[model samples]
Target chain A: MAICAKIDTYEQMYLIRAFEERIAELFSRGELFGTTHPCIGQEATAVGVVTTLEPTDVVTSTHRGHGHFLAWTGDVQGLMAEIMGRATGVCAGRGGSQHLYAENFYTNGITGGMGAVGTGMALAEKQRASGNIVCSFIGDGALAQGILHEAMNMASLWDAPILYALENNLYAMSTHVRDTLAGGIVPRAGALAIESATVESDDVFDVIAAAEQAVEYVRENSRPYLLELRTYRFCGHSINDERAYRTREEEDEWQRRDPLARLAGALAETERRAIEGRCRARIERAIAAARNAPVQDLGDIGKGLWKS
Target chain B: MEKLTVGRAIAAGLRKKLADDPTVYLLGEDICDPYGGAFRITRGLSSEFPGRLINAPISEAGVVGVATGMALRGLRPVVEMMFGDFIALAADQLINHAAKFSWMYNGAVSVPLVVRAPMGGRRGYGPTHSQSLERMLLSTPGLRIVAPTPRHDAAALIGAAIDDSNPVVFIEGKLLYAAEQATVSEHYDIAHTHPPYPAAVLNNAAGEQPNVTVVTYGPMLPVVEEAMTAAFNEDEVACEILAPSEIGPLDTALIGESVARTGRLIVAEEGPRSWGWAAEVVARVVERWGDRLVARPVRVAGRDLPLPTARPLEDHVLPGVETVRGAVEKVMLQ
Candidate 1:
């Protein structure tokens, strides 16, 4: 990747981190209602994979999809307004945080059961032969769902151009990946004769490299590929969760490997300072934009509630 | 015009639609080859359409999800659930994804998909197979629900559903398949449009000045009509029957007007009484023109308990002509 692209990726990841942290703050203040699954620690995974794809390519996201949305094609102000249930929000306040739908990214609220739905979208794209691949972002927990298996089997059998980007944040709410998945997920995909790779999701470049290869394989052969991103969530599962399952040492260890800090450190001092200033300015502007936006009314509730 | 049963009518309609539009495809379990369908509704369709009529695995969600995907890609996919009760397994794809996609996507996408499920209780298929789940689907937004009581209505409704740019849950009554008859046309007539709402008045039986108006749909239409005739002859009351072809976008205007004119209403449904289609009709009528009603609206629905397998118990559990007529008489007395 070029130096400018690398800097842009870093800035994007930082913006996502800042946005999520602000959401966490608002959630704690009881300003934002509803359960929010923050993609705090998994910022690199979202930014990296999305940065690799063109704007025309589509993606299907999980409940913790703010990072993915921001990474691909979402405006920060519209996203914040949506979380606040404002009329000017992306979904006109009907979708709230979980059901946010922007240009190309489709966010599924609490139902992590859309693994097959994403595959279906990919199949449609493939049939259109639009030269646009679909990247389905799923959590490690959703692998247990029967639909994921069905989607994988169908995508593989039909040679659908789909990239299954599994964000293995180690824990699904409170349960660890090892405790939930048998023999882990990568080997499971390998058993199906599908090409699979595991990347250090805390490193943005590592994830980007893996995503690039996966995207290439899917687009070239019209076959599905699985890329397991091994990362961790720095915060609790939701606003109410205290994360009593994991140890303080584990959390601290993962925090030390924060992607934003790693990328900031990789740049020159002047470049790092300039990038940090730009990201802070962007976040401040987004916050100002959201605060000034009008809240959505009950009348607009039914606007985007159904398709015409 | 040759008379044809609702089942044969549906098959004929599918054959016609498939021939007319190459994009149209049929998918379901046992819908291809030697075993056509559980009810033989798709009999001879496999050989006629070749690879277009797909015999999928026993995965209801997979079937619906695949159809939804195909519909998103511009293919007019007609998916069968085998039985209405089986739709529960595919509820995630049907309710969350398909029903909400167009709206969630800000009208950027439309789920032009039709899900055909066999509904109603008449074959003594027990609790699992015998269910009119049109009410369940009607509760879901962005989904157009259609129930055809007669053969012509079935053909018209199926063609309408196929042409519709929205997701449609087309419920076919198992009893209507064998009982009702109508003419089935081969040519695709885009002009043959079924009203999205308001019940179809199959027969006024007693012309104008109808003393009683019986509202029913799906398989129970024949039962209500028969019971209305028997009860009226046994007594001296005149009755008119109205059956709605479309369940969703319910023609409230037609129903309210009919109730206002007849001054009496007796809604008979094969589904559960609580929050069923019958309840919707009563609510709509009362909300719109309750003051004009001669008597309180009455509903005759299936028993709250699960449908029984025993022939005697099954017949007793389902709403028959007697039950409907009794309700009609009771409402008329009030």
Candidate 2:
């Protein structure tokens, strides 16, 4: 059985895909404020990893984190407002898309920085016996950072209840993982005593199965678990990238294996059409509400400089 | 009232806070018992708290990042960076995350985290081990930097740092740890309840007609106090000192008031003269008391060079009592 119904997972994935598509269109028209790293082809991984989490459990995300944020909060209006830098944003416009924080979700613009933070949160939960597990999502490129290794070592040492989920999308902004990363990311963490596993496909059911097992293992063993979710990004690194590195054939191959279409194929036609309709309607409402929402005043930018 | 070295005082403060609050815990390199921290500030803490005192790996960024996460989860974690200099490794976390989490999150959460590190030079620890990095910390916004003067209680300051509903960097002076008996002198006046520990008055023998106001903090407090007293009694310089026990969000008002009255000012510190905390003190004073100054304020601080390993060389490079005394006289005469 799936952690979430197959139909529900499809809806979440559809929301992610539709949200990014709208953001890209908005960016193209100079409507969206900042650049975004869309997870167009990796929807399954984002929703799959997050569905295993309880409401009280925490997660930390990376720069390309819209999908993760939506999977965690499902607050489309607040999230879109944040991406648009509106006052009704989750962070009151201080944090845009890259730095969205909600009830238990936090995403920063820095690579691999959330690793230590998530590990620490897991440590806190274990100390309190809260039974809540933390998941920190990172990309293949973040493997170059040394801080991640340090957090991994301490996580294993402390037996923190955390899932270090890696979305190895083949490229770290065009510099292929093979070119930048030395040795295997899973083995490097394993040397620090972290239990490691890897899922082979980007299929929603496969991701749910692998991620559910990983989340459960960490919860029961009370240790750090590393999961390498094999996936690919259909788009370039960002809106600015020209993609002169990879061939067109490579892009086409990845797009053909799109996680969104794969999940839709698994769902019944009526159910799939309904979920797509709901996602489109919700996205349209969220975008309209976010645009109508007022932007933060220039004077109030520094209002909360310190917590009195 | 308690007789304790600065190190012991810090340990006592941690002990008390942990006992009082179930949420408070400690993490740092060699912080557990048997090792008791590099300077013994965490001595016997692990034995008392057991699993609460966690000895961390040599990963400053990881430790601080983890502490920030813990704070996010509502745990009051006091992290000990073995050396204040090593805090540079964790600067990104302190400056970007811990310092701004609540504010960036728009007051959605409060990070009640404490980072305790020993600062200042003079223990022959050389460049990497010894540095008065408080100057760098002072430049970081949204973070409270607190240091202790001999007049203020170290443990009390630590307790205050822990109690603060924000991220605080509690800088402990290595030299202060060597004091066999801790006694807060009465002449160094002024005492505030919280971090940015209250500024003090020194060498006000003339009471109402003090000739100069010298501002300093941390380990430089004693040296500046001695110099001010010697200048007042022998040289008739009549100096009044305003030294905040805490550093950041400096209490420039106290120094400004004293400077306005004296018409002369001197800022003495252990860090380098260029871009030191003295620069900030001078800037704040000049903004308000520029018209009142009878002479240009002098900054007495370490030379802009790496601290040498030899004791004599280090003393020569760092600002000394004679240096402060001379600056006081020079400012008074002008």
Candidate 3:
């Protein structure tokens, strides 16, 4: 059972990597419109944290949220079509890459904005006594937003069932985390008296373990918890980033400990090869379907402005 | 007919909604017992529905943001901004998240959230506390703006706003909190458009055609009404007043038809003169009835300056009965 779960985790991470790689290629070829924030190196955090949530448990994500979306739903075609701006898109191509929604899944482009939103959702769940927890994801950059702190205080004070997953990728856009952030992220949550833990690893299994413990604590105690995943972005912030801030050696150093490669070592070479091939083929099919989908009509511009 | 003040009417409306729906919850600053909100609208509500009337901190943005989340998660959350001026703090959440959710998600979800704000200047709250900032929230798609006036049924309007699927910003006048909301009048025959928050129309009971169409909403409704009464009694000026409780998706059809009959227009608002609701009404009316008017429409609005703390200065800054009557006379002449 453990081995099967491990294989599923590895498969999910590889699928995200393949999807992002294709997105990058599509952007470079000018096949996709609008900007995209690819979570190339932060796949393990999204997969590990999201896979721990129940179907009733809600999750809120940020601008770079494709990894989270895919991990939770794994609807490659819907996401691909949405990103490609087709009528068959998740939000009918109106939300583009920054905004997305599913049954219990929500994504926003604003940094740290979902902190309050997730807390509110958790409060609602607590009131219902549904035993459902909410997991909100933000980056290290979101620490600058005041709404996050406000949300943390409210969540702790109310003892809302929520888990705040902060993926510290070391940089916010071109600025280094050290230059932007003043204090430690974990200690900041601790100052608010929110139960917190930090997992410094590129391994998917470690993230999953930490997330499981955090989710359990939040659900059991009906309290808010924070989990900090210390990782590195293997690719630039966005597809068109020039990568002028960091050195090639620095990139190479993080690349050596790639989460995909680390997980692949646990599997036999044949199994790893077979999984990678299948994921790549699935991504290709999604891209073809997205490309073939029709664009929305101009007359439908005012369709969803107000719910009828 | 029971003469209910705006505050009591809104409180009754909220109480009824809470009793009716289990999913309904109220979030606001000091909304519970001992401090029945800043204006006492939520007084006794806390005792009625324990755990439902949440006492939020001074975090305005968090209150609205969390309410948006609650709405997204199938809860009808109504938030109260201590003062409408402080709504500027929650602009990002209201404008970006709440307003955009329905459209952004392609109607996948709806935010049935109501943010009740105590607006307008009169109680000497100075700059930060006293303001008609609805103009700042204007023109936002998927966001409904409704303000109950003295002539309209405040409770019904609030009920409609809460029952709405989209996010509605319910603006309540601070002065109107204690004043009587007279839904009936003897001088003018009162009528309303269809439900889901309707525009209240006032015409002369004598069946005389009005010479000027005065369009207003919220706090300015009474001021315009008073001005029209003064103009009528003193100078035999018949002006039809159209005060819609819903201002954002404003029922411009009523305004246009009234203006077509009068052939002269006077739009009044409590906000500043530049790019206010008055401006919107004038632009919309002109666009609809271009080259079909007796004279150009006139707008009555507050002076474009920060409201001063002094009583005299504040009165000078905000639009008064005299200012509205002057506009009525000006439009009547042309």
Q: Whose TM-score is greatest here?
A: 3
Evaluation by TM-score, superior candidate among 1 and 2: 2
Stretches > 4 Å off in candidate 1:
A190-193, A297-300, A304-308, B1-3, B20-23, B183-198
> Of models 1 and 3, which has the larger TM-score?
3
lDDT of 1 by residue, B1-334 (tens): 5557888878887888999987788888899878999999998989988878877767788778777867866688899989989998888888888888777655667788999999988788998999887887788888888887763456656887888888888889998888656432121111222354335564333354767667777888778767776776777666656677777757677677777778898889998888888998899888888988989989999888888888899888888877987897798798
Ranking by TM-score: 3, 2, 1
Query: What's the CA RMSD of model 2 in angstroms?
Result: 2.0
What is the per-residue lDDT of model 3 for residues A59-89, given as tens digits with 9 covering 90 to 100?
9999999999999999988899999999888
Candidate 3 lDDT for residue B111: 92
Q: What tier of docking accuracy does candidate 2 attain?
A: medium
lDDT by candidate, in order shown: 0.79, 0.85, 0.89
DockQ of each: 0.45, 0.76, 0.78
Q: Model 3 chain A: which ten-residue window has the lowest total lDDT?
A: A299-308
Candidate 1, residue B307: Cα displacement in angstroms equals 1.1
Error of 2 at A234 (Å): 1.0
Q: What's the best-to-worst order under DockQ?
A: 3, 2, 1
Off by over 4 Å in 3: B1-3
Candidate 2 chain A, poorest ten consecutive residues by summed lDDT:
A1-10
